[model samples]
Target: MNPTPTYRDVATVGIGGPVGSGKTSLLSELVPRLREEGLEVGVIANDILTQEDANRLRERFAGVVPEDLVAGVETGACPHTGIREDPSMNLQQIDAFLAEYPGLDLVLVESGGDNLAATFNPELADYWLYVISVAEGDDIPRKRGPGVVDCDLLVINKTDLAPYVGADLEVMTRDAREVRDGPFVLTNCKAIDGIEAVHEHIVEGVLFA
Candidate 1:
């Protein structure tokens, strides 16, 4: 039987993407910013083999995002199946977080950035952001993966490399817009560009109303 869950004011948000698409880096950036704004944030990192992402986040976040706020799940090779097909482990981690940090304002559930086929269970988050990278190729948006089409917000990251990589930022975003039928954003997380737009969108779209 599962242990009693700890309760918190956490609003869960799921972040998913393909490998090298910058989900962890984005978390490294977001955790501190959220704290600066006085929002309590927790995170659950789901990985296929080990707690690598959780440890990376703990080391990277340092003092901002608490050590306990990050939990890791072993997906046993099928990462998407862990988060989407069977999320019992994920739920347990979340319950544990809420039990510990009762005042937590948000929980960022990060899937092991795998492929375009990955997405989160609605049961896991009030909202979810699916990330893609400009370096992955411009046609990714046109592929219409459930991740691209169904996520509440689609984040096109690594925009700073667009020119070098021959990725068409405008067209990629246009295709994302056409497919998502929701907001699409461009971010250069490495350069810290356009992140405020993400923050603002979050506040308005999920945090407030």
Candidate 2:
């Protein structure tokens, strides 16, 4: 008989970035789009001590995703500990999801706000995205942190705030290209700008690829 399938049987995507980088906002936009395409998507939000992000997502996806499929993992430590260093907790959650939803097409894991050094364990995410805010300054990409340079896609969010924050989008664009061999998208989550490109990358990177 064929062995029972596990989380590995489904596609997993990781979204990591610094505090207030708009990871949840991106998820709010992406999940509905994926559901509209007839894809069953699960979501997990990892926070140090609170379920704030997860709870917010559950509310946002109330009609789109089943309440049970959206979970929160409190790592009790740095966000990276749950997503990168020791992903056992996250893995177990994914396993639980697969048990109830074997046909699940994708799982999006959002790490608690972290520094630019955060990254997902290969065993945890099939594809990963690193989100940064232009408000954080255009120098973020130039720093070449692992999260920025190594993620499959680098998302520069809050572009609409660039002018007010004195962040130069052009410099960020140039620096991101210089640091990452992969593609990056500039997004304004509030207005849903450039979200389509982000969705396309995920569809191609993990869903269809």
Tell me the number of clashing residue pairs for each predicted model: 2, 0
Using TM-score, give the best candidate's number: 2
Give the per-residue lDDT digits (tens) of candidate 2, residues 66-122.
999999999999899999999989988999999999999999999999998999999
lDDT for each residue of candidate 1 in 82-190, tens digit (9 for 90 to 100): 6788777787787787777777788888888677888887666778888898999999999999998988889899998999999999899789878878887899897
In order, the Cα lDDT scores of the candidates are 0.83, 0.95
Q: Choose the strongest candidate by lDDT.
A: 2
How accurate locally is residue 204 in candidate 2, as Cα lDDT from 0 to 100?
98
